[model samples]
Target: MTKPQKAIIIGAGPAGLAAALRLQQYNHISSVVYEIRPKPTTLGGAIGIPSNGLRLLHRLGLYDNIRLRAAETSNLVLHAIKGDVIGKADLTSWSRDKTGFGYLRIQRTSLMDVFYDAARLADIPIHFGKRLVGIVENSDGVTATFDDNTSDTADFLLGCDGIHSAVRKLYVDPNMTPEYSGVVNIFSLLETIMLPQARLSLDGLNATLTTDGLLALCPCTATNEMIYWFFSRQLSMPPGGGGRDGWEEKGKQEVENLKVTLLELLKDTSGEWGDMWKAIINQTNVVKFYPIFRMVLGGQWARGRCLILGDAAHAMQPHASQGVSMALEDVFLLSKLLEIPGRSLEEVYAVYEQKRRPRTDRMSKMAERNGNVRKKTGPWQLWLQECAISGMMSVYNLCRLDRLGIGQKELAYDVEEEEV
Candidate 1:
């Protein structure tokens, strides 16, 4: 009798948990997930699980639970800062018929809860507070050492540790680091009652483009009572600032200053829009700020038996909204590759990179371009943005681009059958 290969997954986010579930379904492999956090907690704002991600969750039997807790977003509305409706992309029936799932927006906490529950039901052992200190990989397997000096050995290691991955530093490339994208984001969650008038206007996902930034308001719950809103602006770091660390250390003060700035910027918007921004500011109890960063496109995804996925491998701007979906796709591809018989771990790793890199690179470049468009700094650029958005809207309405496979290629991936 052959022993089942053991896999070690770092980080318990969507990618890691999904990987565990898929691997457990295979007869030849078993997995355990190690999360640094003591418990599952909300890390950031709401997330949009697009068709690609939703389809995979559906396969895992988690779609129904998440759907019940989240809002099914059917349309994306684009508006000018002055509150004039510029365009819209309707994705109601198109998503269902084309991709087998609809885009869902929910709080990060809600999503994590579902993943956690699913992991538990699958009997996957998740060790909390296991902060990775170092990883050593050889021909036979990989060993991970944690902060407490404990270690675990497994047939392979998957780094889902996110953008600041310690695994990447130890194994992949020591020189590679995240580059700041010259944009700062401030965001918060507000109750609908606080913005009563604004609630009346939010029939769907709403976004406004300004000369210096973009503001988006998305419903986070099915009842439409809680709203997730964010502002991303082109801001340069002050001289001698420590970048991300500095932002974190001074988060409170910076958030307050950002709130004031956001209120001032909202004044540029026409009537209800301006009032809505003010209401969101006044009603929020806590505000968070972070400087956006992106990894350089195209890197070695695997070194020996250790592999990195999700934000750890290809972090991108939020503009494309493919971050989570891309992460889900990575694990799906990996799970499929691992199921093939007579393949060495290295061979599987190589094929995974070959299949995933192109798609992720394309999305990263598109996200960068989208960020640039949103950061329009001049009248000419703003005018160009309006024209481009309007044209795309016209094309989308006529052709139903979402249904025409605009972002469905990743979603349509077929999972391999379980070994009988």
Candidate 2:
């Protein structure tokens, strides 16, 4: 009997967990996940699973379970900050017919829970509080060192450690760093009771565009009992603003200041929308702030037996809402490559990077462009955005662009019988 290949996955996020599950489907591979967090914590926001991502999860037989806790949306409603409807795009049947699944919005914590449960059932070991500190690779395998003064050896190492990946820093390329997008996002969750009027006004994923920035409110539950919202604005960094280590710590220290800034922005909005925004702000128990950052795509993804996937490989702006989807797609592709017989680890990593880079790079550029358009703050820019959105919605409706599922095609992956 052939010995099973040992794979070490860094980070227990969607990508890492999904990769572990996918590897389990193959008899030749055994994997474990290491998470830096001491325990599972609420991700505190919502994430959208587009048709492509939903379809992948469905194939893994986990979609039905997740669907029970998620909200399905049929359209995205664009509204002006003053409360006028700007445009709409149908996503229900159109997405299902095109990609074999509908779009879903669910709490990030819920999604992680589903993945975690599935991993547990599959008998995958996920070690918490294991912070990766260093990696050493040899011709036969790789050794991963954790901060706890322990080490693990595996035939391969996969980095799904997110945008601030330790694997990427210690192994792949130290010079590659995430670049700030000049926008800061403030996010909060509001219960339906807290913002009853806003809940009544939102029919689907609703967004408002203004000179200040974009405010998007997305329903997080099927019953519309809770809402997840975010306010993004172009913020100029103050001198010594983020400190030496960046905004992670600064964000915590300036929560009140951030709230004040957001409240002022809301005050500028008029009518019921303004009221809704204010209600959301007042009802929010905590307000979290983070600056958006994008990683430069198309660089080395692997060295020796170690490779990086997902945000570790191609972190992009969230405007396209493809971050998680792209990460899942990476898992699907990499798993397939790993199943190939007689291929060296280095060869598999090379092929994976060669095949995945172009697509991820393209998506990264598209996401950056989308972010730019959404972050417009001038009167002329806002007018142009309105016209562009209207035109795009018309084209989407007329040509049934949603049905095409253009960007989702390459993302679709089918596991082979032998791999399963």
Candidate 3:
């Protein structure tokens, strides 16, 4: 019998937990997880899980659970800044038959709960509050040291840490860092009764292109009594603003300032439609603020037996909503490569990069375009955007003509099927 393989994983977020779950399936693969955070957080807003990610989650026995806690949207309806409907992208029926799953929108915390539960059931050890500060690799394998003064040696290490990955900086490339996306995304939760217009607009994912930024709203809970919404806009980094460069969450005073800034921008909006959106911000109790960031797309993912995945490997602009999905895909693909025989750890790492980089590069570019489009638009630019969207969605609703893969291509990202 072959000896067991030992693996060390950093960051107990979605990527690390998913890696632990997949590796537990093979008795020969023994893995351990370490997280930087003190404990599990129910923070963050809703995330959209695409079909490619859904497929892997299903195989990991997570899809059914995710569906139970998730809300399904039929389509993403687009509206102009002035509250006129422009287009709709089919979300439910178009690709269900082909992919065996539709898009899922769920809170990030809910999904993390599921992953943590599965890891516990599998008896996988996850040490929280253990931050990775250093990594050392040799021909024998890799040794990872945590802030707690604990160290572990494994056949190889997988850096599932987030965008500010310690493993990547200490091992892969110390010079590489995540660049601020210049957009701060603010999300809030509100009762369905807070805005009647939003309740009526909650038929699906409602995305509006405004002069200030892009605002998106969706019903996340099953009862449809609560709505999750977010808005993205640019912010300038003040010189010597004392940690205003977008790292830590702001204090109570700063939060109030954010609300004031937002209200000032939307103060001009006047009407029932405007009130609905403004009320969403004014009446909310909890607001999540995030300064988006992205990494250089084309870079080395592996060096010797150490490699990175998830946000550590590629941090695309959140405009595409594929950051988590890409990480989910990476862990599953790595597990599949582990099944291949006669391949050294380094060899598998190379194949992992070979299989994944092309897709990440494409997403990186698409996210850039999408992010630019969502930025503050001029009069002519907003008009052109609305017209283009109206035309494409009109055609898709009429003839199901999705040359840009609106409903078809996105919901069916089966790389193996494509190869066949």
Candidate 4:
């Protein structure tokens, strides 16, 4: 009998967890996941899990449990800067279709908890506080050293450790670094209030382009108690002034400083819309700023037996909102590719990149274009673009590009690498 393969995944976030869950299905393989954050704490903001993300979760046996904890939105609303409704995207019919199961707007922590629980149920071991600091790879396997002075070796290593991935550092050209776009994205959470007019004006999960920046608000969870807000503008000060650039440990003072510009841009809004901002600023204890940056796909995703996925491989603007979904897609696709035989790990890794890179690259460019459109300042240009988007969305709720594979056949990722 062939010996069981062993794998180690760094980072227990959604991407890492999904990979773990898929690997768990192969009884012969022993897989372990390492996370930096311990239990009882979670990562940032409201994540809109479109039908694709939900589908992956469902396939992994986590759909029902997660759905029970999240809020489902039937429609997407578009608004003007002054709190006026420009368009309403009805998703009721789409939500009911086989492909369009709508979207679940859930707290990031809640989603992580569910994934963690599901992984536990599957007997997958996830070690917390194991921050990956270094990676060593050879033709035969890979070894990861964590901050806790622990190390593990596996037949293969998947670096789902996020943007500042240690694995990527080893292979990517040092000159082609991730450049910041000079925009600081401030994400805030607020107590959900029932103000149909305000909600419609801001466009719940439907992005809205305004004069100053892009403001997006979406429902989170089922209780109507929490909502997610994102506000962005060109940064006059450096990212997290006088502090490190990482968003994970940003200070409240910096967030407060950014809120000043946000408040000015939102000055015209009134009634419940204004109140929502006030509540968000006053009540929220947690906030984060992502200095938008884009990474060019330079290095091959895998070096020897070490591989990278998700933002670690392709960090792009969030305008596409596919960061998580794309990562989810990676888990399934990579799992299939790893199941393949005859070919070497490098060959399988190359195939995985060939099949996935084009799609992600296209989406990254689209997101950059979307950001440009949102940042358009000239009156005529902004109006024409918004009207065009509104018109397009009016007829078809799903973006044309998204519809092609929306909940359809899972991208036929290769399987010989993992097949027994």
Pairs of colliding residues, candidate 3: none
Q: Which stretches of candidate 1 lie over 4 Å from their true place?
A: 1-4, 91-95, 241-245, 249-254, 379-384, 398-420
Prediction-by-prediction clash tally: 0, 0, 0, 12
Native-vs-model 3 lDDT? 0.77
Q: Report, for every candidate in turn, its global Cα lDDT versus the true structure.
A: 0.79, 0.78, 0.77, 0.69
lDDT of 1 by residue, 1-420 (tens): 123389999989888888888788754478989999998866678887777678878877888999888887757888776667789876544546656787889888898899899889989999999989898877667899999999999998999988888788878766668888877777888888889575766866788877768888889888888888988887766557655566666565667587676676666677676677777778887877878889987667898888999999999988767788888778878887776677877788888887788788988987887787656466567767877888888887788776665755544444332221
Clashes of 2: 0
Q: For candidate 2, what is the lDDT?
A: 0.78
Write the residue-wise lDDT of candidate 2 on 1-420 in tens digits.
Answer: 123378999999988988899888854478989999998775578888877788888877789988888887657888765566778876555556656777788888898999999998999999999999999987677899999999999988999999999999999988788888777777877787877554675766888887777888888887778788987777666457555465766566557675576676555566777777777777777877878888976567898888898999899988777888888778888878776677777777778777777778887887787677546477677778788888888787788775666544433433222132
Residue 18 lDDT in model 3?
87
Instruction: Order candidates by lDDT, high to low.
Output: 1, 2, 3, 4
TM-score of each: 0.90, 0.90, 0.90, 0.82
Better of 3 and 4 by TM-score: 3
